[model samples]
Target: MPTVNDVEWDLVGISEIRWMLGGLSRQRTNVIANTKGFPDPIAELEMGKVWLRRDVEAWIRDNRPELLENKKGPTPE
Candidate 1:
């Protein structure tokens, strides 16, 4: 609730309320994260999307690390 944008912006934000209520747990993080105004709205909702559930990047990292590699280490300009 109290995001990096809130403490410096809104006077009394939802974060304060959560703090007053003895702090929210990690499980509740998703509840608020999916609500609105998160850092990345698209990525936030992607967690709930069935099609975007799995991490393709992780899949690539584990199964296809070769796909991403910086072969060119240095260059003399």
Candidate 2:
């Protein structure tokens, strides 16, 4: 939850995204990932893709505002 010296940003993969969206299933996460204009992942590793937490959260705020209503602050742990 710490962004050291503003260089180490938080990242979120499918698991974190799912957890953020209330335990969404993998398929659901895929659907969201495939959505047009969904933020492009900052990195794609062997496990899957990873997105900057801020990018993902902003996308959610703009595209799915409801998701952010109950969430705590800009980033949720």
Judging by TM-score against the true structure, name the best candidate: 2
lDDT digits (tens) for residues 1-77 of candidate 1: 44565433322233442332246664564455454433222222323421111233343345445544533355668
Off by more than 4 A, model 2: 1-8, 72-77
Candidate 2 per-residue C-alpha lDDT over 1-77 given as tens digits, one digit per residue, 9 for 90 to 100: 33556655688999899877778898999899879999898779999998888888888878878777767557645
Predicted structure with the largest lDDT when compared to the true one? 2
Per-residue lDDT of 29 in model 1? 43
lDDT per model vs. reference: 0.37, 0.82
TM-score of 1: 0.24
Error in Å for residue 19 of model 1: 44
RMSD of each: 16.9, 6.8
Query: Which pairs clash (backbone N, Cα, C closer than 3 Å) in model 1?
Result: none
